[model samples]
Target: LSYVDGFDITRHWGNKSSYHSANDFDMTRHWGHLSPYHPADSFGIQDIGIPSNCEVSQVHILHRHGQRFPTTAFNDGGNTQRFAYKESARWWASGFFDNSDGGSSSTSYDLLVIPEDGTENNTLVAHDSCRNSDDDIIRCFEDTTQGVFTNNYLKTVLARLSNYLDPKFNLTIMDVYAMQTICPYEVAYQGSSDFCRLFTEQEWIDFDYALSLRFYGNRSFGNPTGRVHDIGYVQELLARLQNQYIYVGNISVNSTLDNNPTTFPLGQPFYLDMTHDNIMVGVLSALGLNYFKGSPTGLPYNITHAPNPPENF
Candidate 1:
């Protein structure tokens, strides 16, 4: 956490590279994907200066869940079969997995069994203590019928997690993508883990496009032509949020829980909630924070350019 101003040209003299820069604070939003977290992207204690006269009162916060593999909606195979096909073809051309007798066909991921040595699988192990020799890793890339955590997603995630821990840590996936997204950042600073590093930059961009299709595609109402803001999805999210609280004036107040035993916001000084990015955006839209009847030429929803540094509430 400690850093010097410049490159600290003392690497030969025993100083490690701990340089700091003002650019560290400039934040970029990657929509819960595998993006590095800049120190400046988040608030630091010192950055939230102490008031000279006023005392701190209450605080409320909401944040998106961690970066994860694409959601089940995209992992369902049909949506991502094309990407998998392309990536596998590239791997086949590169002879990346040729060290093993993983079969001759790159498209048949089921037949591809990774070799123990001389292959990148040596660096990849899952949480189940199952090394990469099995078809788990390739299953993620090749299997078109797999569900979110069924085939290889959870195992790959855990194996990647086991790399940094005491090796006995039973890292589990909670049937969600946020945890999947969040865990890799722990080892991201180390710049290791091939499972997390499997995609090229352009590949990631393509992967993002697939994700956009999952969220904003024409499968749902109000999504014809791949509209960015799906009115149906937005309404659904608002209805779900309404069951818990109602937006009153400038803030959201909890709905009366006459029959429920849960405590209200009576004694709590701080409240924190973690949810999907779509829910957060939907909440903002419900509040009419930046309401828009954008024209067809306007920026589409999921495909549009996001605000630089992303706007803060």
Candidate 2:
């Protein structure tokens, strides 16, 4: 990463060979929302623990395949089934969740499948309100960053990784990315992948950087309607938090479920709802949490010593 990507942390963890465990090289850790459950960096407040005077009260887990970051979750490889099995409690997950062995019959009521017929409003799956048009900030970020990424990041990655390949076979940018990406998947399903060893930890982090640019911009707050896409669940969450049914509607909140106590029970000690990882990120913006937010204006993050953000906001 010193000459290849110039990552800041590369100086510290650059070529150190001691940090060699499967845990150290796990690419799933850097997949943003798709990443497995991990602790946020200890930057804000330096301590996130509640006051000692306070006692544990309510718990709401907005799960994807398993536990995610604060107020969000996602689905991943071998870890996917591990979560479902460990929960052992109630399972309120998406019906579409299909592992290698399918789902357990014990958690039948947990299934929530939304048809793409465009009628189900209270769903995090492919929100149409936020994605109805393409001329929004998503397109802007893509148009602005994709080329820069290709010319700068992708080119460097391809050149460095190509050295390991046979000279008879040429490795394109797509080939490099695909090979790097398949690590997480192969590990999740098949248990281990040889591709996992092809890149350094910094390379994985940089590839994760490229992915962060795409997902954070296209699916979450970087887009114009980022929060709006996942507001339904947010509202439902508030209702549960306050032990009251939501009164306002016409957006994503499906009144039928939120209104019904059977579907949306109140005063529960714990709550779990599984959805898409992309929406999990959008939920973060909807809740207005600044933990992962690098910039308020939602401009793409630049990995430079001094980032020259555009003026005239």
Candidate 3:
């Protein structure tokens, strides 16, 4: 058996026209960037050489998600001051403002009355311990919208892929695997808070619109802040993948037709694991080669190699 990762046909086309202005973005700029589309020869299939004896029984394509919205929050001066002094002080000290004196204590923003030791602090504090200022929360909502857009874009890409595969193979019953941890990490203001409320209807609408823009336009929200950890999850995934391969390999080798062998003849049969750049790096770490290096050409692991042979048959 032989393996050839499905070629990425869209890389040379650049982002959709709706995503950029004519002057700013150019598809040709990426013409020779060493993507799957940039074959050394005239024929695109020349890049992926198929072995003569081996058959393409299966193809596992693990691809990165499409371009994402910026995840970074734009904290202007007003937002900074509002969070640092006002929200922080109110949350930390539990003190009320002077205006809530006459209103019902439960719904009021008054912070003067401290709850007794046994008294439930639920009313005074937020439901989620992680809270950010109004602006920050709005920004986060916007960022989340981008994630939603990414999902939709992925669906579109998959639909196109399905169409492309329909003629060549029976893709109707192909199994698709998506990572469960495929979500944007939340951006919290301080370590103490976990959730922020988008109080106004306009704020909610704006967030949805921002997400739409990110999906349709390919504008990034910027990078996320705060700690993002994936160590345990990654380890679990790796362990499962290894166990699955081991079991499958053992079954194949022990079958009545096969002789005992040290290694699986064509290597363990498996499909691609769809994941993010972060997860790819995590998997690579266990496989060694942890040092930082430049991008991947046609070569794997940043190592240079001769181009694959052209199709002889």
**lDDT of candidate 1 over 185-282, digit per residue (tens):** 33333432323333223223333333333332221111322222222233323433344332321111222321122422223444343334444443
- Per-residue lDDT tens digits of candidate 2, residues 85-176? 22423332223333323345445444344443445664555364444635655467644554455345566677878787798888887777
Candidate 1: residue 227 Cα off by (Å): 14
Which 10 consecutive residues of model 2 have the lowest summed lDDT? Answer: 1-10
Model 2 CA deviation exceeding 4 Å by range: 1-28, 33-55, 66-119, 126-147, 161-170, 296-313
Candidate 3 Cα misplacement greater than 4 A, ranges: 1-48, 57-59, 70-272, 281-292, 295-313
lDDT of 3 by residue, 39-128 (tens): 223434455677789876544333332322222235211222212222333332232324333333335332223222222221112111
Q: What is the C-alpha RMSD of each candidate to the true structure, in Å?
A: 21.3, 8.9, 25.7
Q: TM-score for all predictions?
A: 0.32, 0.66, 0.22
Per model, state how many residue pairs clash. 7, 3, 17
Ranking by TM-score: 2, 1, 3
What's model 3's TM-score? 0.22
Q: Model 1 misses residue 4 by how many Å?
A: 24
